[model samples]
Target: MTMTDQRRKEEGTLASLFEAERQYAPVPSGDWMARMEALALEEQPAPRPAVPAAPAPRRRSGWREALRAFGGWPAVAGLAAACATGVWIGIASPETMTTLMSSDSSSLLSALDPASGFDYAMLGL
Candidate 1:
């Protein structure tokens, strides 16, 4: 057949297919929609019951409260560090402490009695 004849035949087939689609409009019934809604609600999870709140905590006193005021254990550790540093310096010092602790009359008496015109710088220390 000619090309014109084939094009006309295809156009007729498409026109009839669209005409048949326009003649029908399928829709769900009211009872079907109600049933669908009811099914949706039934498929949902159940709600949980309400729970009671827990009781309040007890109050702290005496040493426990005092410890909190001192910023807990870390502050105590800092205080211990300071005390240790002081003790270490006092024990490890060689020059001033050694001269001060000497039982010799001149050195000990001179270091104590600042009125004796004893200048620590005179020793070239």
Candidate 2:
């Protein structure tokens, strides 16, 4: 067949298919469109009054403020000195520590034993 004849056949088939579709299609009701138009035109109701905002509570200045107000700079310095002394003693003294954390090095090695399932052997122990 010629190319012009093939093109004409395809156009005829497409037109028939479109006509069948139009024949089976449902027509739109006028009342549905009118109702939709009325709904679109209708105004929404006014919103309700908003609740009054709550007042913020006054905040306390806490321990630092108390230290500044009553204890003063000397008290603060004494507290800081005591804290430093406690830390120094904790690092230097062995007897003051717990038995598990004492100068006994074997306790740490035994705690890392593979028989206990921790497998320190895998780390070349």
Candidate 3:
């Protein structure tokens, strides 16, 4: 078939279909608005009995419970070690720690310099 003929046939079919729909479509009465208003004003059926609210869940107390859950005995041991280290530093004379740290640092610096032979000049030191 030619393009024009096919196009004409399709258009005629669509036009007939729309005409059939218009003829059969239900037309609402003029009182549709009044009927709708009455439905809106009428008491609605009682709401289905409210389902009882579930009991609120109990909340766990914060940090302490979290720490216990996460680490248990291992966590306790780590805390004890930290506390002991703090106490040792607090009790020791400041001069003693300074001297020890200074010597250790010097030894480490010397070892790194001689063993690696790295030049500080490369770092713009």
Best by TM-score: 1
- Candidate 2 lDDT over 16-77, as tens digits, reads 77667778998779999898888877865667899898888767578767887758989888
Error of 1 at 125 (Å): 26
Global CA lDDT of candidate 1, please? 0.79
lDDT of 3 by residue, 1-125 (tens): 99867765788868677667778999888699789878887857766988999999887689768777869879888988999999988888677456656677655564546544346446544
- Candidate 2, after superposition: displacement of residue 85 in Å? 0.5
Q: Write the per-residue lDDT of candidate 1 for residues 1-125, one digit (tens) a residue.
A: 89857765777868667657767867899999999999999999999888898788887789898888989999988998999999988888767767678668767766677555446457654
Cα deviation at 6, candidate 2, in Å, is 99
All candidates: TM-score: 0.29, 0.24, 0.27
